[model samples]
Target chain A: MASVRNLLVFRQLFHKETSTYTYLLACKQTMKAVLIDPVLDCVERDLKLLRELGVQLVYGINTHVHADHITGTGKLKQALPDCKSVLGSKSGGRADIFVDQSERLKFGNLMLECRSTPGHTNGCTTFVLHDRAMAFTGDALLVRGCGRTDFQQGSPSTLYESVHSQILSLPKHYKLYPAHDYKGFSVTTVEEELAHNTRLTKSKEEFIKIMDNLNLPYPKRIDESLPANLICGVTDPVSS
Target chain B: MASVRNLLVFRQLFHKETSTYTYLLACKQTMKAVLIDPVLDCVERDLKLLRELGVQLVYGINTHVHADHITGTGKLKQALPDCKSVLGSKSGGRADIFVDQSERLKFGNLMLECRSTPGHTNGCTTFVLHDRAMAFTGDALLVRGCGRTDFQQGSPSTLYESVHSQILSLPKHYKLYPAHDYKGFSVTTVEEELAHNTRLTKSKEEFIKIMDNLNLPYPKRIDESLPANLICGVTDPVSS
Candidate 1:
């Protein structure tokens, strides 16, 4: 095994139709990086940041097709021909790499273990960076509340299982990084989430009852976002 | 002055797009009624409610040209031909009766005093139902927070004054009924708003700072909502 030296995480705030957070994670020793859940319009800025940091974009990974903002994986790959677009196995053939649950990707000295946590969406996945002890748990687990389970292919039961059996079962020290938060505070611990998360801490029955009662309407940008996500965030030229 | 009598305050939730709340104020003896911020889709519903309650609809008043939902005053007039559509003096010629600050509209035994409370929108007004000891504040005051002062010619300074000097200056016991609330808590009071509203309680400098820091992207339905509001919720056949 190669010796891991330094790891860097870059996050960008894109206040699109809804506020979205996109991240770039890089292994300093190898200069290899992965882009996660990036917004389409912010690809150039991400690419610029990569160039400035001397990181080579290796993979564009989407946790799930977002309902609020269009994903930028396809455009990022188009702009950087060497990069591969990856999604979970259940992502319906929309990805270059169909990653399975618990699959591990090794980049130089760093290893990222995929954890299939499909509660927010059917194909939602959390990426656990083994070396950094950090997990990027997209919309599945927000700081105070969980992602609304009343839209698309969301299910409260699946979310309960994902949070309890997969995420909370992880090492308590693992830092949880969510995809979107208006407040600047980004990283939290699995222990803190387990203790404080209003949604996750509830009993499965209580959770389902609460979610059912919420009856949150569909995201306002769903109509505009789906097409872009389907094409991997490539906007139709005419619309753009 | 007409003899003081029992005041009946009725509210009907209308327009899901904006969750607009329309109110009917009637004096128990006279049955003469005044409509406030009626939704366009709920005109028939309002009529049904009025007829069922044995009340007469005499006046249709709008607090402001709303940005979240279309107003039903025009359709309401088409149905209740005898009722007059009243609005703020600065409604840009969309209202049948343009009323100014402190303009009082008397309906038999009930009296409604219109107070200019601009901030959420330029011509926004709040109706003080003096007889009911309640004020229909529309979007000017909300539970826990105030309306965003970032769209449709909104100014934080104007909002600060509107709330502090206009709405907050009212009698402490005056109950407030806003136009929209997702939680279904239909009413709050001036004292409650003053104490609990996060947005309104801030100092002018702090309020501006908070507003500046918001840097929030436009609301999802701004384009869809503004045009409908501008024409006082009357949509052209082509657009609808």
Candidate 2:
């Protein structure tokens, strides 16, 4: 663990109420870091931890515009003047930098490859480090289940294509980090998701049928969250 | 419980991740209900429950401006056209109706007496059902503790005075309902709090010391939640 800490300082933080996961990745030498899928509620906590570790934050990367929680990007940028906010190119005009597939976001000596995965939301992106050491799947891919495709311009067909072509195509050992999990398991491998993912393993039609019948309730914060998130997290300028 | 249900068709709903509580109080005769401290995520579930119970929602009332989650008042109004959004008068003209102390919110043969309970926030209100049958204490008083007075216009002296005069002054058996409780207990009595509340039992100076040293992490959703809540949970009119 100590040796790995030196290789790439990584930390997975959890917001217990929303079951959201935020990943922090830092280059050990330069202490330059970026947070992925940050929850607005934990900005102070995240910033405090970064300060304690002597890391200067560079970016707050949202996997997509989330429905369940608000993003911390605006607040983070307010606190740290140098830190930029990143999202997928299709995320409208929300963040500071929006990258497309195959694009890379570099922080110090570390680099994360962006892959377009638009199923759960039209702008969902998977961020993977060099050599596929880890892939931050956001909500498109979860532990055993995937994100519900009932709303937010989500489609089963698009998700199936994205997960299969973009995620499973990688080496079997690439570690998977999801934005959320309710069952408490963390960090599944591409090999394991290939074998055990209840949603992704089914045929495309079956997957579609399953998603269609999920009858999931609407996310509570969607109304307020969606409107605020459309312009990144700077919501003070929101209009009714 | 069934007998009590007959008296007032009450339901205590819990949002597990954040430990926030929302209370539904409906009058059996008119089948009209009011929700206190409604979370944004549970609006659909709450509305569905109202549908199943054959009750029409009348008011979506908040105890105070929440930091952890978005309020459901705006969404509820959108879903049920007749429902009104209620908040404290000091809420800066954010809610549909600004209620002051001693104001009566009546529906179907039921009435809740609103009492100004400041300190947690300048606008915090405690609603007392007819004849002091129950008191929604909100953050001013928790099950065994109280809301942290470090932010959101919180003050230990104000909270202490509010608790003793506005809350603790009620009969010993007046059941207490709070906006949040991490310990999983649903309800507590004024008598129970008088004996067990860690903060209220202390002297005013000691209580202030305890609140000052909490050193709790800033709530994750404060930035988004505060701004959105200040406008009665309507962030759609939000601008960048």
Candidate 3:
């Protein structure tokens, strides 16, 4: 186990337009970094911040193929020659690296254990940094709210199982960072979610009914976001 | 000094309408808590979170008398009978407790050292929790930006000196949490602000010039917010 010396450099960046969160994490000692769920519109801002922090970008990883905004991973690769675009193997999104369940991705001295947490989408993955007790849960589990399992191969039963097994099962104190938050909440703990998650705390059948009854409007940007995201947000849609 | 055992329980709550950040800090061992810069619009949400956390409300502190939005201190005091409304002595606002520069306010086992960082507003203050290397900079220093010094006794020269002497003087790695963020930035470090703060990084003259030329529109809520905030956001305007 690593000593409690605070070896990780972390920053949470937000995209106001889509209410998306992009995280930048770097290994302090090696200056190797990864950007989780970067947005296409804020790549310049993210890049400037990365440069100011003086960290080298190793990977631009997305938690899933988003339905609201395009990913910045492709544009990031174009800017950072050494950066790779990463996504879950089941995500069906083209990327430089396709991570699978239980795969451990390494950067500097830090290791991210990727847990396949599908149901919000089959490719939704939560990256857990066990040493720090932090998990970047894409849309599988949100603060007090879980993702809508209404589109893109979403299944309420599967999402419920994935969250309970892969995310909620983590240590209670683990800090969970979600992909998007409309409210002003920045982070939530597994402990808090366990006690307060509006939907997931109910019986599985109740959860299914709740998911089914959500009368949400179709995502406004779905048409544009889905296609662009599938090709890793590149206009030309070419694999690296 | 306390041992490094992660003793403080922290949560950053946001008000979307005003772009205000209300921070909740609690002593894990004592279960005593304080909310810094709470917004009037989110009192229900804040109270619910406090109840869920199982912490006793010690103080509801505002960093200043805001013009953009009303403070939640008054409403919080009404909701949490034991909670006191707190503000800077210079704020000229009615509050249960008036703190001044260099005063240490205690909540359970945690101590917040108050530093007056005026210029954004005469009463604008920054609360530093030295043990955790965290500073709640209320509208004084922002991420790559500083509060506009053009209203309510706002002086560019004073703001520059206040920031350089009080906030920027903190340890370089100390995380700075601002009261409001228009952009999606949640927090910044002292080091980053020193290096990249567009206004503060410049000379006093340049900063003054920048502040002078910034033809920002009049604050829409100032007329309503100023009067209500002066009495700590109570419609009745009575101090507890």
Find the candidate with the highest lDDT and give its number: 3
Error of 2 at A156 (Å): 0.3
Candidate 3: segments with Cα more than 4 A from true spot: A1-5, A237-240, B1-5, B237-240
Cα-lDDT of candidate 2: 0.83
Q: What is the lDDT of residue A164 in candidate 3?
A: 96
What DockQ does model 3 achieve? 0.77
Q: Scoring model 2 with DockQ, what do you get? A: 0.02
Per-residue alpha-carbon lDDT of model 2 for A116-195, expressed as tens digits?
Answer: 99999999999998543789999999977799899888999999999999998889867888998774345676877887
Q: Model 3, range A16-134, lDDT digits (tens) per residue?
A: 88889999999988999999999999999989988999999999999999999999988898899799888999998898899999999998999899999999999999999998899
Candidate 1: regions farther than 4 A off:
A1-5, A9-17, A235-240, B1-240
- Lowest lDDT 10-mer window, candidate 3 chain A? A231-240
Please give the CA lDDT of all the candidate structures. 0.74, 0.83, 0.91
Q: What is the lDDT of residue B24 in candidate 2?
A: 88
> For residues B79-140, what per-residue lDDT tens digits would candidate 2 score against the true structure?
89899999999756488888999999997778899999999898999999944378998888
Native contacts retained per candidate? 0.00, 0.00, 0.79
Error of 3 at A240 (Å): 15
Cα lDDT, model 1, residue B156: 83
User: Measured by TM-score, how close is model 2 to the native structure?
Assistant: 0.51
